[model samples]
Target: MAVPLLGEHLLFTLRSPRLPTHAGQVSFPGGVVEPGEGVVEAALREAEEEVGLKGVEPLGFLSPTYSPQGFLVQPVVVFREDLPPLKPNPEEVAEILLAPLGELLEVEPWSEVRLGRIVWHFPWRGVDIWGVTGNILKAFLEVWREGKSPPHELL
Candidate 1:
């Protein structure tokens, strides 16, 4: 028998007062791809290193995306058999916020908010989740809604 997979993807927010590159905003658990690492491996490794999630089994790869910084990114869709309670690394993550995929899909188009030089939304939290990570999530949700795959670069 195939084990049932949870339909909702966990949307976590990093809690760090000092803004690294995209600081003081909401984002997924990911970062720069390391040397000689594939996209999925990088994602899983980042997840483990930043959020203390080890041995996460990646289900599939979505698509290759280019970050605003010019490096190519791959969003890995993964599942952890048992999500050990999150222990965020202070240097990378401060807090872990769990967002249900269903809620994100059901959410209305985010009400726009402007922060410094950028514009996005704090639709879920009072925090703005923008940048490349936000784009990836938006694209993923779009594909989930359309019932057909969309090109990664579209987002």
Candidate 2:
């Protein structure tokens, strides 16, 4: 799912740099749910903490994707009716970038470099947005383009 922005769709980015797992990578601001938090709550909470976005109205839950690093990440889709200007916490996020989803949907503009059996490349900037997060986005975009949900395996 995507959010409407100025007659187009917009997606937020988390600029994570100098880390162990996904250092110097650009990603959506989310992580695994904590002990007591549900997927919806965790998604909203993480978005707010990682990037100071407020009043996010969660539309519904999407397919949960599995991370190779052992995270079962539920993609909770949301819409920001009155979103506050973002202020990313440097400890967790270095920068926040907004991209038009319509632009991202144009697959012709992206190159898919195959790494392994399941590791195909979708390059954006110097960072490779691959693996679980990239898979989720790929599925999401397929759904958007085809007007039907792809057969997603549960994580």
On lDDT, the candidate that comes out on top is: 2
Which pairs clash inside model 2?
none
Q: Global lDDT for candidate 2?
A: 0.60
Q: State the C-alpha lDDT per candidate.
A: 0.59, 0.60
**RMSD from true fold, candidate 1:** 6.2
Summarize candidate 1's per-residue lDDT along 15-76 as a digit string, tens digits: 47786576656667777677997766777777777777765556666666665565566777
Clashes of each: 2, 0
Candidate with best TM-score:
2
- Per-residue lDDT over 73-146 for candidate 2, one digit per residue giving the tens place of the 0 to 100 score: 67766665433577887887877766556666764334343433243345555545666657666656666677
Clashing pairs in 1: 15-94, 15-95
